[model samples]
Target: MDFQRTLLIGGLAIVGYLMILQWDKDYNQVPTTTQQQEQHQTVPSTEDAPQLTQAKQGASDDVPMLDSVADAPTDDTAADKQVVTVTTDTFAVEIDTKGGNIVKASLLKYPVKLPDDNEPNPAPFTLLERSSARTFIAQSGLIGPDGTDSKGKATYQAAQTNYQLNGGETLNVDLSLVDKKGVKVIKRYTFTKGSYEVKVSYVVDNTSSTTWQANLYAQLKRDNTQDPSNSSSSMGMSTYLGAAVRGKEERYVKLPFDEFEEEKFNADVTGGYAAVLQHYFVSAWIPNQEQLNNFYTRKAGSNNIVGFKNQNNPLKLAAGEKGEISATLYLGPKDQKRLAELADGLELTIDYGVLWFVAQPLFWLLTFIHSLIPNWGWSIILLTVMVKAAFYPLSAASYRSMANMRRLSPKLQEMRERYGDDRQKMSQAMMEMYKKEKINPLGGCLPILVQMPVFIALYWVLLESVELRQAPWLGWITDLSVKDPYFILPLIMGASMFVQQLLNPTPPDPMQAKVMKLMPIIFTVFFLFFPAGLVLYWVVNNLLSIAQQWMITRQIEGQAAAKSTK
Candidate 1:
């Protein structure tokens, strides 16, 4: 086959693969409606109820609690609960006194997109909110046989309604809840300067004569609601919006909202975390790694909850003794480096599809380039150049093969005419001609096949990188994550593809040649709605390939002309 035909087949295969991916994302997805989730909700049985294991004699060990507590008071009690507001450099959070739950959180550094007619300043992006149409909050408390928290029923009183980190290094806010049995539980939230991770600690004070035993549970609760900022055009390439977990056995597992409605997910692992993942942000509860823990996913009313709890062992605090259980709660963007430092496999929440092995290193290279250039757009261009340079030798060989095929086109056509009635004779003549020229018929395709994965991986890297969101290149091109509003980059890419095709041998098959002629138009139209950064990468790659192929073809043609003259 000719190089142009091979290229056409490869392009069609890629397009088909992408179409299948989009189809699976749209049609094959199991919808998880609010009604369906409600239907799946069932009352917890006694055996399934979380219990604190009995404390050993003279053993003062801490017991782990499940991630979520059931039967928490509904919205009716929210009116009675005091709202404590905590402000830091990066976050503005509201904690409810009812259960010391983080009822609302707003990212102070990130602003929501404003309407065209709106004022210049936009409000901060709210990650957790409690409204009629949406409800998302972080809840944590103690639950066990002798626990005061009956599914987070017990209410707490915050020391203050407003707390601020006024140029200070760290801020601490405490909410105290005392039950009728004289068990005191203090929920303390610790915030550090310029950090998204909050240190949540539950200090249990056993004042009663008998031993006090309970388990600590922390969970994230959020209703199924689509993000308002996600545009309709990008819906086909929707980002993952559900739960993710990382454990010792399972490196990274996703429990989408639909799967949660189908059945409950239960697992036991040491040093694992459960998080609610969205496009660029993640909220997770990181439990103590040394302790055995249980990861769970379930539906509660209109909310989907994913969390982890301590194992069955109950924490025992003797009379007049105090014990503390704590976990880190991270609520922020999906910064891969930061997430990786937080826990193993947490960075996988970025979701680079199945080609993560290639995509990850590509991302690292892009990041390194960005560190020096200070712009994601230029970093992408330079990265594309680096990738092309790395594969230049292979591509040069492929181009040489195509040049040989183009040189032999006349002889091959003559053979076809000589053996017009015999298919076997024509095949034998073509093989002899190829052998005489020392040409490999399949040489061009193998290099392309090998490089295809890297190209696809780079495509995903550009599509999913949050760093490029709302970033700008030169004139007209802004927001590399979105499509080019003017559609100029895609057109340039198509033009480059057409020129590259012209420099290679044309297919003999009429239908194949026609398809090859139309590939540029087809791909141009397809890429019109693709991300501008991705289009930029393609345009640059095509231009580079054209330059290389043209040079190689010219060099081979010059050498052949000199030999003929001799």
Candidate 2:
């Protein structure tokens, strides 16, 4: 074909290839499969409801022991309510719209984050009540006149609103306590949604004259419902108190929720299990060491207790008195950059997974490169260009080989027609001819092989990079993290590939020629499920390569004409 026709065919092939990729993805139905282990697992117990222990009489007044009331019905099953559960490979969430609380959130993944849609059986945080998606409710019992006794149970109302988030939306959770005593306590929790850490501001107002005192605790609890028969049950649910601990050798210090208020104590056991949440780092509005003992966890399971410090001043609430305190909760994810943005010391929350040493540095470098440009899509484009440029010498060598092969096509065709049925002789002659021309037959394949690693690295960069979450590109490409709604980029990519194919003359070997002809179709099918941004990068690179090759081809033709004249 003439050069102009070659370019048109190549361009059209590429466009067609990309279009096929996009269309194939649309019809590609990812089969849903559940593990047999998951189906056989036993249901978790929502019973054993968490309760604060009170010292029985006859126990020393100074030493108050914590204990649970045995007969306090813990059955979570309610009449006439449909409970919806969402689970992943590691986590299971039981959302009860009837109770208005996430009754149980079992941590199947030791360190998990909000699930992404790409995950199989993704468990997302959803609004129980559609009428008010932001509204969340909890039941904390009423305070006695003295503020220490339970007059009755009072339900607490917490609502998370104004969630119109565009990358940097702040979470405002309003927590209120409504009681029959005409007493009310309204607290607000506010923090940027971009980071998982949270801050709480408590405002308690009581119209009663009786003094009221209440203790505050940050609760992080999960149910263990995994069937004992399943291997995952042992590794199922885990909680890190303030921060995630690194390495497998060190385990969490287990303490009971109640044991924290007392003086010095320690417990240790070899066999059974008990877990204590540890803070990789913590900042709290609590008191000093001199007033009370700092609580530590004993490896023992049976004697677990919470760590605590004595109150420096009474949370005194007289008639018509209002008390307010503001504290922050670092609910950070296991992502370093996000954790780091939670005011320096907060990055301790990112578990780093297993490969923190290597992954951390890679993440840092990716973040640094991304910071240079605000558009995440462009950042990816620039990153791809840099990588390709770094390996340009290899690519150039491959292109040069193809150029030489194209120049010798006329001579190779003559040999092919002359020795049509002499397969062995034709192969021998082809090799001898290549040696005479000083061209490497293996040249094109080596560079393509070397490009694989860079491609894999970039793939990980796009998949793991949280910075790209909800990030937008120019038009119709609102979320680079998700698939493109319009398949424009992929179509362009396929067209470019077809163009690149046309520029390089076909091989004389029948088998090799057949494979080359099918390269565009083979690649189009492969690119179907690839992220739109990734396909776009390939399209741009292919187009750039086609232009470069065309220029080289023209240069060779011009030189040959000049030599003929001389």
Candidate 3:
């Protein structure tokens, strides 16, 4: 086979591989008035239903049951709805007084849409919601022999309906509950100054004659709703939208919603966590790391739940004794460093795929460049240049080989004409000419093959990093992590690719030449929907390649002309 023919087909295969990596994502956008719509849920609720009940009713399967224990009915099934709102520097959360559940939460730092200076402050992105369209909430309670939620939803009383933390290091929101039997329980939610992890604790004051024995359960219940925060949804480039658990053997295990019926996910995990992941954010239950807990995924009524429960022994307290049971809930962006600090393998949520080894270093370099330049777009360009420089020697050798091939193109064409239909003679003449010229037909192809993994790894880094969300570089390129609105970068990249091809020797075969001519156009259209950052990288890389190839080609041609004159 002709080496040029092989190279052209190989290039097409790489493009095909990239298209396969991207899958279509169905985006069912929520109504613009999600805030107003959330005020009244679609769930059929009693005029005076329990406050927590309204938020926990995404589906019938929202709550979990203990082994051999059925939940008993509650006396206040029609209790009035009541919630305590807490506002901090990083969060706006609503806690239901009934179960002390985090019924609604808004990430104060992130907005539902990019802010327009002309418009009022954009509303905070709603991370947890309770409505007919979306049901995602954080629920936790004591559920064992004498658990509050074991006998239906537990109700509590808060001192105030609203709380705020500003210029303070920490804030605490407390809800109190006292049973008729004299057992008092205080559910406290602790928030730090700028942290997304909220500690949900249950302080039990067991004053009853009998011992208080109950296990703590924390879980996230959500529907299979589309990820609204996914800005990387260009041409169906979707991120993971499912549950991920920390495995003893593996760093991360993905539990997709569609796999719920295939089998029940139940495991005894020590010092582990369970979480529901979306495009840029995740809500996780990082249980007490010291205790051995049970991590599970199951359907509650119509809801899919991923959470943890205490194993081995329930919290036991004798009469007149007091104790506490608590777990931390992280609800915010998936910052790698912060997530890694929260729990082991939490940072894996920022998935870089099989080439994480290569992607990790690329991300580090990209971030290091950003730290120096202070602009993600400019930083990306610098990173690309550095990457090109690192491979300069290899690229130079490949360009030299191509230049040599171009110098011999006319001679090979003359031989093809001389042999006419004698294919055997043509092959022998081509081999002798190549050997005489000391040319290795495969030389130019190896360099690109060697660099493919590195480039592919960079693709994932640009797609997965949340730090680049909404970051801008110069005019018209607002968000580096999203597709360009005007598509200027893709056009530039396409043109650069075409120019790079012009620097190479055109294939002698008509069919091969046609495919080579179409490559740039095909890639330009394919990149139209790619993230702006990725396209910027490609455009810069191609421009550099064209300059390098042109210089090498000119030098090689000059030397050939000198030799012919001699």
Candidate number of the best TM-score? 3
How much lDDT does candidate 1 score?
0.77
Model 3, residue 98: what's the lDDT?
67
Q: Could you tell me the lDDT of residue 14 within candidate 3?
A: 72
Query: Candidate 3: misplaced stretches above 4 Å?
Result: 1-60, 66-79, 415-428
Every model's TM-score:
0.81, 0.48, 0.87
- Pitting candidate 1 against candidate 3, the one with the higher lDDT is 3
Off by over 4 Å in 1: 1-79, 114-119, 227-236, 410-425
**Which predicted model would earn the best lDDT?**
3
Q: lDDT score, residue 379, model 3? A: 92
Cα-based lDDT for every prediction: 0.77, 0.46, 0.81
Q: How many backbone clashes does every candidate have?
A: 5, 21, 6
Ranking of predictions according to lDDT: 3, 1, 2
lDDT per residue for candidate 3 within 251-300, as digits (tens), equals 68888987865666888878888989887899999988888888888765
